[model samples]
Target: MRVTDLTLGILTLLGGIAIYLSAMNFQAIPGQEYGAGTMPRAVAFVTGLTGLYMIVEAIMSGNRGIGFRFAEWTRSGAALARVATVLLLILGYILVSPIVGFVPTTIVVLVVAMLTLGTRLVPAVIVSVVATIVIQQSFGKLLLVPLPRSDFLSFLW
Candidate 1:
């Protein structure tokens, strides 16, 4: 199940480039020495450096080239099942969110995900419900972002 550090480093380097590119578009503050983009750009620079170091470390570990194989899912049905279930859950969430509203959709996804991962029924239900509420509040209330309300639920909205 161990992945190659070189692959991770390459991915991290790409991520850093993305962050830096996005940060470049951020508007700079007129009076402030550091603009909104400064900190993010700095982080991106660090990520790039760290990724480079990881690549070098991987090489120094005597591991040759990039072809690290994944754990054989064909040999482990349970592992494959778990991965498939999570992917399906994510797909369902995307398709359902705008139809049922974010709160209800998130609740269902979290519950299903926990159950699929073999969590106990009672704990899964409790955690799913709590997590759903917290996420809703965090995005909807604290962040002042309005969640999508289904047309079917328009009356409630």
Candidate 2:
């Protein structure tokens, strides 16, 4: 599916606004000058600016077709299924991660997403496992973020 720049810009602008609003709720650390919302607010500002630029450009170009147009690929059930599966996988990960642990949840989500995108099974599993470990190490060790751990597989962490 092809969306007009105006449509995308509007959506992006709204998303940025929502992110900014949500980030405002982040609590400030006692001795820190910059709080958790700092980075997100900055990113939201930039995203909002980018969306504004896109909207202006779209209007200036005067070639903005209907808000969105469907491409030939949209008619393919397989293509639609792939998109839907990815969305569902993300939702599943969010709901299941806390219960099953970040490592297993992320690995499963990645493997399914890769396979849905036509990656081979073995390669998908390998990449998913490797990527999950990298992410776990980066967040849990390097960044000092505590990820949920599964009681059944605590050794994995």
Candidate 3:
């Protein structure tokens, strides 16, 4: 766990740095308000600070457990399979969204992911469908963000 913490800390630090650098690309807005980069830069700074704290804590504790040994293919294979499944599901949604539309695509993706994560079929399907509708409505109506909707489901609009 210590080694895992250290690794994650290092990765977080690197990611924070990357985010900070990327945020530099956004130009600051004039006198009225904050620029697009402001929030991201702030988040990056905080993340980097937290990561540094984690590293310092790890070093001070001196608990060096067994680190990552890729010699064991079983764990690595399982991790890869999980990642691949998620990627495939996401890709499937992107490909099918235009045809079946956003709600259906999102429903299918969510259900598959929930099932893959070991949820029972009935509950998974129910939760997935409900959550998709809620999220879609929240974003489309409350947030006023236009979500893709099928022409067939135009009545909802």
Q: Which candidate wins on lDDT?
A: 2
**Cα shift from native, residue 106, model 2 (Å):** 0.9
Q: Which residue ranges in model 2 land beyond 4 Å of their true spot?
A: 1-69
State residue 22's C-alpha deviation in candidate 3, in Å.
18
On TM-score, the candidate that comes out on top is: 2
What Cα-based lDDT does every candidate model obtain?
0.81, 0.86, 0.79
Write down the TM-score of every candidate.
0.55, 0.56, 0.50
Full candidate order by lDDT, most accurate first = 2, 1, 3
Q: Who is ahead in TM-score, 1 or 2?
A: 2
User: Which lDDT value does model 3 have at 148?
Assistant: 73
Candidate 2 global Cα RMSD: 7.8
Clashes of 2: 0
- Candidate 3, after superposition: displacement of residue 157 in Å? 3.1
User: How many angstroms is residue 14 displaced in model 1 relative to the true structure, after the best TM-score fit?
Assistant: 2.1
**Better by lDDT, candidate 3 or 1:** 1
Ranking by TM-score: 2, 1, 3
Ten residues in sequence with the least summed lDDT for candidate 3 = 63-72
